[model samples]
Target: MEYFQHEWLERNLNWFEGVSKLIPSTNNALESFNRVIKDENTLRERLPLSRVVVVLINTWSLQYTANAKTVHAVPTLNLGLWTKAYQWATEKKKKIVSHVNSEGYVYFIPAGQSNEVTDLEETLNASFSTFEEFKTVAFSIWTTTIPNDSNKWIEGTCNCPGFFKKLICKHVVGIAIRLKYANPPAEAKSVPIGAKRRRGRPSKARQALLVQ
Candidate 1:
């Protein structure tokens, strides 16, 4: 990190004057940005990907200096995971069962591929005006699964047709937004243990096969 700072200093000799005015002469501005990035990811360990570093760079650059309300970069979590899943599923000749949980976790179930397992800790969360209202919104979003029927098994499995195409599907994003205000479980539960459940394949099997 220090090496990078020194390298940055060397490269910015010409821009030094303007850079100083924009940030500071302390040169610790990058460190502060890095700290913010760490907090955003909730990571306690070293980053596993150079892409993560790029994300941090972009996110901090925007938040600290760009003065933009929201950075329109790739989603730091879902999009990365989704791309990986799509790649794996394609390579191994498999499919993924994706759905939004009541708690707003986007569950990704790989059919015949992907060495990765479903992470109980999902990136999604819910939102609302108040905590109680948030919980209500969470419940509503979870309950609003497609087919417009009270089919728990069908919904849990994400068998609905319009799910994948709608990037920020109403039911899914709604629950996720609600989760922002809801209290989290004090003790994390282990992987859900119950009867094995399957909710059939996508109608877009051809589309799934073409994903590369």
Candidate 2:
């Protein structure tokens, strides 16, 4: 038992946490493909060699052909991450509330909305407000950054869709902004998420044709 425990400790989660930041060690594309094979083809039971060949060619071959043209890309660019982080820092930084767990290795930062017209502006033009860290059930899901870092924003992880897709997000970056760990570059204008810069000129308003 002691030997097993020693082996497990040597290969503990901290070893893989760093790996996850680089590349998901256990939850990679190949692992997902293997899971599909086990679940759909074998059903956790050993199949005959002939059946295995049938599953691979008939099922996976078509899937590979279909996705051959598919291009995998990170939606959030590095600049975009910083830009959105700056926006979040401007708008939602006031809402950031943190609580340190007993371990203190990681902390929570949650935000919420306000219906008040003044609060909706979300600018630091207002006076600075003090934030306290403690245990409380004050906020709900989606409003919180799922950052699992002690100090480094570069290593922080967020549960946001943006983060899930890109492994980085405004929430985590906003936390970094609050912590003063890193500053967004000067070119990172505080543009809201989903706002796109239109190419060329806007079309002139057209009058409806009158029945003649």
Top of the candidates by TM-score: 2
State candidate 1's TM-score.
0.17
Candidate 1 worst ten-residue window by lDDT: 182-191
Tens digit of lDDT per residue, candidate 2, span 1-103?
4443456446563542333443543467778778878998889889899999998899778877998435444333466567767776666334443455543
Worst 10 residues of 2 by lDDT: 129-138
Report the Cα lDDT for residue 113, model 2.
48
Model 1 clash tally, residue pairs: 9
Clashes of each: 9, 0
- Model 2 residue 194 CA deviation in Å: 9.5
- Supply candidate 2's per-residue lDDT for 184: 77
Model 2, runs deviating above 4 Å: 1-77, 92-94, 102-140, 143-151, 190-212
Residue 169 lDDT in candidate 1: 30
